[model samples]
Target: MSKSQGYDERLAVPLRWWAQGTMLVATLWLTVVVAVPGPTAWVVTGVALALLALLLWSYGDARVVVRDGWFQAGRARIEAEYVGEVAALDAEQTRLVAGRDADARAYLLLRPYLHRAVKVEVVDPADPTPYWLVSSRHPEALADALTALPKTR
Candidate 1:
């Protein structure tokens, strides 16, 4: 098991995705070189590569963190006091929850690349969102960290 820094996880895309993306960019470079065949082709390929890099970096920048009496998934956060009933979901369970049994008002921090997730119930009655479904590579660890949080309320 990994040491818990209060359960911090970055949802990075797999390396295979990077490899495939790079190959695609190479293909784009080839097409541009064959069609245009000048400095314009180099410029076009460079811009396309830069854009691809930026998109992948931004897409993988999302994070899930639980620390200092708070839980966060991507841009959304909630106090630990308001969190309840954390569950670690396997691939099948996550698919079912995210697809068949999803609540309309639930806050989901889902990534297509991630198949496992953690379901966190929101106990705050004032909040409109019912629960949070956050994708995690290590869902059990995340659930354990969340469960260990001290609820002030």
Candidate 2:
């Protein structure tokens, strides 16, 4: 089967979050430079930089893509035929699905920082997973793509 992309997006950490994290790292470095003795301050800064780099690296790879009749969120991919009831959720609803009323059997690709998300019901009876809750910066678009899977297939 020919693979074609229907919707592709990375739920990137917002720019403001990057800015805030950078500022926080700088603050920690400055605090260390002022209070800590010896070369420990520079060591602390290096460790902080390493941690920041690791954080950005991991966050950068997470993506949501609809292609080849499949929907991928983070590390999980499900065929479009098994995806149903695509719901675009606002911040409050997203939080509720991801937190308070969350199901243990549901697959979640959530980013707590991203307020918007899409909930897709899984129709495969053999699969124990009931649904997938995924973070999306463009929830409506993601939901639309998911709902339109039948046409794409």
Candidate 3:
């Protein structure tokens, strides 16, 4: 039998972001087409399409997956043994920890659109990072999974 996943999520960009980006791209296309005209108009449309594709691709890259005794956020992954002191943060606290009172050594996988977050401490003595501040729509669930990890070296 296979072990079940503890936590798995893709942190996607908010719909409003996509809407805003599309509006911006449309405006740019209009400006280019209006100013240049003819074949240049088609070039402008192609550029707009390319820009939108790139934006979506980049924004969809971040993910939080907790499985196989590992915590993966964005492009970084660490073993559960090194994880400690998971704190679920509300919008206000998330903002404070992620911004003003943030630790420089900590790893951050933050998305501006995500207001809730979880802070996971790194207990590895050799590692300079204090904790990871990660944006999560389900902070409590993520925290619970982190807390459930067995303490080990």
Candidate 4:
């Protein structure tokens, strides 16, 4: 949980077909080493595999799910008991970005393919923070869902 002003946000791991393709390629590359000879092949293969795993883990986990009265983000499902407020941020609206990101930050998750996102606000005296900036695929839908959730005390 990070803090700043009067909002809090939780993120999830980003998963998409492109990323899956990368994972597949990495896996295949590692498998190819089996055809190589010598101990050096094994060593190089191990290193390559390790690097690939790290890359997958890095991008495989970058999503944000917000809930009020609860805390759920990433892989862990959070109950809606510790959440505060809901916030919607998009590049088209925020204009707080560069590149093609300007018109696409209006979805559920950020992507090179689609550029939008939403975040949960954490506004408790006990948890004083500003807001979380997240990327999303369905900006309006995510915002609507978050806003529709019942407010918490």
Query: Can you give the TM-score per candidate against the true fold?
Result: 0.96, 0.83, 0.91, 0.50
lDDT of 1 by residue, 17-127 (tens): 889999998999999899999899889988988998899989999999999899999999999999999999999999999999999999999999999999999999899
| TM accuracy, model 4 | 0.50
- Leading candidate by lDDT: 1
Estimate every model's Cα lDDT from 0 to 1.
0.92, 0.85, 0.86, 0.50
Give a tens-digit lDDT track for model 4, residues 49-100. 6776676567656555544433434443434433446556666644464334
In model 1, which range of ten residues has the least summed lDDT?
A: 1-10
1-153, model 3: which lDDT tens digit per residue?
A: 112558887898777778887888788888887899889877878888787878786887789988878999999999989998999999999989988999999999998888999999998898999999999989998888877765566
Could you give the candidate ranking by TM-score, starting with the highest?
A: 1, 3, 2, 4
Clashing pairs in 3: none
- Score candidate 2 by TM-score against the native: 0.83
* Residue 14 local lDDT, model 2: 68
> After superposing candidate 4, which stretches have Cα over 4 Å from the reference?
1-39, 66-71, 75-87, 92-114
Angstrom error at residue 140, model 2: 1.2
| Top candidate when judged by TM-score against the true structure | 1
For TM-score, candidate 1 versus 4, the one ahead is 1
